[model samples]
Target: MAETKTPTPMFPVVQGGGSLIVAWQIKGKKVVVVGGGEVAAGRILNVLNADALVTVVCPALGLNPEVAYRVAQGQVTHVPRNFEPSDLDGADMVLVAVDDPAASSIIWNLCKERHIPANIADVPPECDFYFGSVHRDGPLQIMVSTNGKGPRLASTIRKFIAKQLPKDAGRAIESIGRLRIKLRQMAPDVEDGPKRMKWMIDVSDAYSWDDIGGLTDDDMDNLLKYYLSGDVPSLNVLKGLPDGKDASDIDLFDGSFGFSVGA
Candidate 1:
C-alpha cells in the first residue's frame, strides 16, 4: 500500500507579513554570485557592503548600468565567463540565480560536497536560507527574513520599521564607543572583566532616561579611584560617577585617590 503525503507548512506565506532576523559575518570572505539579471543584483549588491571579495559569473549578462560601472571601476570584479558547477570551488558562500532548476541543482550539490553554505534564489529548500529585507540604524540593524516567502512585503515592512528608530541611534552608538575608551582609561586598576562590562552596560542602560552629559571625565576618574582604593573614600571624591550605581557606589577607606585632593 502507498503512504499518504502531508501538505507542507505555509509559514513563510502566513507569517512573512513583514520581517525576519539573522546575524552573520561576511566581510573580506570569498563569495560567488552565479547569474546576471536583477536576481544576481540582489546578492552582489549586498556582498560588497560587507567588503567581501565577490565574483559574479554569468555567460550571458544583463546588469544595471551602475553595477557595470562599479565592475569597471574595480569596486567589484565581474566575470563574463560561463558558470560551471566546479566554479564554486573554495567559496565561503554561493548564491545561485540562473533560474534553471537543473543548473541550480548541480551547483547546489557541488556546494554541499565542498561544505559551503549557499542560497538558491526563488527556491527556498534548495538554499541554506533566503535573503531578507534589512533595516539599519547604526549598531542597531534589524533584518526581516520570511524564509524567502515574500521579499517585497518584507522590504516594505523594513521601510516602516526603520522609521520607528531615532536618527540619533548612530550618534548614540558613536557616543558609547567613545565612552568605552574613557571608561577603560579612567578605571585602569579595575582587574575584573565582568566589573568593566557591568560598568559599560550600566552606563548605556542609564541613557534610557537620564541626560548622559552627567557622565563626565572627572566623574570617571573619581569612580575609578573609589573602586581601586578598596578603603573608604569621601562621597565628594568622584565627580562624574553616578552614586549608588554599582560596586563603585560607596566610598572606600584609606584610599590614595579619594573624592577630593584633600581626602
Candidate 2:
C-alpha cells in the first residue's frame, strides 16, 4: 500500500482569539471618532443610532454625505482638527478611521491606557472589536460576524437571514413577553413555577408568528388558564372567569389540553 499524506488545514488556528458578542447600551454615552473619512462617517452613524454623543476629530470632514448632513443638523460635534490624545478624554468608546497607520496606532495605545474599547478600521489586529453586519426588524436584531476573517461574507449572510425573518416577528416577541409576565405574576408561589415558566417559554417559541401576532385578550387569558390547569377553555368560558379569581379553583379537564379558541 502507498503511504498517504495528511492534508493541511486551510485556516490557521488563532490562539486566544474568539469574539464575545454583546449588545452594548451606549445611550447617553460619549463616543469619539478620529477620522473624517467615509469609514469614520459610517462609524458615526452607528454611534448616533445608539443615542450616544459623538465628537468627530479631523482636519476636515470627508465627502461622506451622512456625516456632512448630521454635522449640519448639529447632531454631531465637529472638532475640525487632527487626532490628539486629549480627544479620547471621557470617551466611552473610540473609533480610529484615519488612513495614517501611525496615528491609528497612537490612538489605539491611548485607548488601551485609558481602558476604553477601540476599533481601528481595516486593522483587525489593532482593533478591540469588529463592527459586524447587523439586521434589525422592529425590536428584533440579528448580528453576523466572521471574527474579522470575512466581512463581506458576513454581510451577505446577514442579508439572507434578514429576508427569512417574518415581518411581524417582533410583535410576536412582545406578545409572548406580556404573556410571560402575566404567568409569573399568577404562579409566583407554585412549587413547579420554574418548570411551568420554561414550558410557557417553549410553547411561545414554538408558536407561529401569525398565531402570536393575532392573539386577543381572551386568547391570552385562555392560554394562561390552559397552562395552569391543563384545560383549554372556550372563548365564552374564558370571558366568564372572574377577574383576579384564584387559578386553583378553576375546573380542569382530565384529558389532554388543546390550545384553540373553540376548545
Candidate 3:
C-alpha cells in the first residue's frame, strides 16, 4: 500500500486592507441627510429602506424631482434650508451629498467632533465610511466595495455576481434559516451547541442549492433525524423531494438595475 501526502495549498496567505463589512441595524434610528440633489435622493432612499428615521436638510430649490416627491409624500421630514450645526444633535449617522465643498466640509467636521459616522459623498478623504454597490433579493444582500477607489467597477462586479447567482437564492437562504432555527430548538442544550454546529456544517457540505431549495417540511423533519444518528441523508433521498422553481425559468438580469439596492 502506498501512503499519500497532502498537496501544498496555493495562495495560502490571507490578503488584508478593506473596510469592516457588517450589517448595521439602523431601524428607527435618526439619520440626518444634508443635500437635496440626485445624490441626496439616492442616500435618502437607501436609509429609508433600512427603516431609519430620516431628516433631509437643503434649500427647497436644491431638491431634484425624486427628493421633492419623497418630501411631498412626507416619507421623510424636510428641513427646507441649509444644514445647521444643530442638525447633528441626536443624529445616529450623517450623509452629506451637498455640491458645495465648503458646506460639506463644515458638516463633516461637525460629525467628527460629535463622533458620528459620516459619509461625505464622492469625497473619500472626508468619509468615515464608503457605501458599496449592492445586490438585494428578499432578505439576502451582497455588497461589492472598492474602498472609494472605483465605484463604477464595483457596480459592474456586483452585476456580474448577481447574474451568476440563482434567481431563488434568497428563498434558499430563508429556508436554511428556518432549518437552523429548528435545529437550535431540537438541541437547545448549551452542551450540544458544538454538535449542532458540526451537524450544520456537514449538512451544508452534503446539500446543493437545488437540493435545499426543494426541501419541504417533511424533508426537514427527515433531515433533522440525522443529527441524533450522526449521519447525513443520502443524495437519492434529497433528490426525491419535490422540485422548486427552476433556475432557468426566470431571467435574473431582465430588470436587475431598475432600482438602486444600497448606499
How do the residues 1-263 of candidate 2 rate in per-residue lDDT, one tens digit apiece?
Answer: 99999889899966676798998899999999887778888899888878999998876545367677778899998888777788988999999898889878888988899999999999999988889999876567799999999999999999999889887888887887787787777777778677676767666665678677766665686568667554444434544566554334555343355443322
Residue 123 error, candidate 2, Å: 0.8
Please list the C-alpha lDDT of all candidates, in the order they appear: 0.68, 0.79, 0.85
Compute each candidate's TM-score over C-alphas: 0.69, 0.72, 0.78
How well is each residue in 121-196 modelled by candidate 3, as lDDT tens digits? 9999999888899999877899999999999999999999999998688887877888899999989999998898
Model 2 RMSD, rounded to 1 decimal? 6.2
Ranking by TM-score: 3, 2, 1
Q: What ranges in model 2 sit over 4 Å off?
A: 1-17, 181-196, 216-263
* Global lDDT of model 3: 0.85
Collision count of model 1: 10
Q: Backbone clashes per model, in order?
A: 10, 0, 0
State the displacement of the C-alpha of residue 75, model 3, in Å, after optimal TM-score superposition.
3.3
What root-mean-square deviation over C-alphas does model 3 reach? 12.5
Give the winner by lDDT: 3
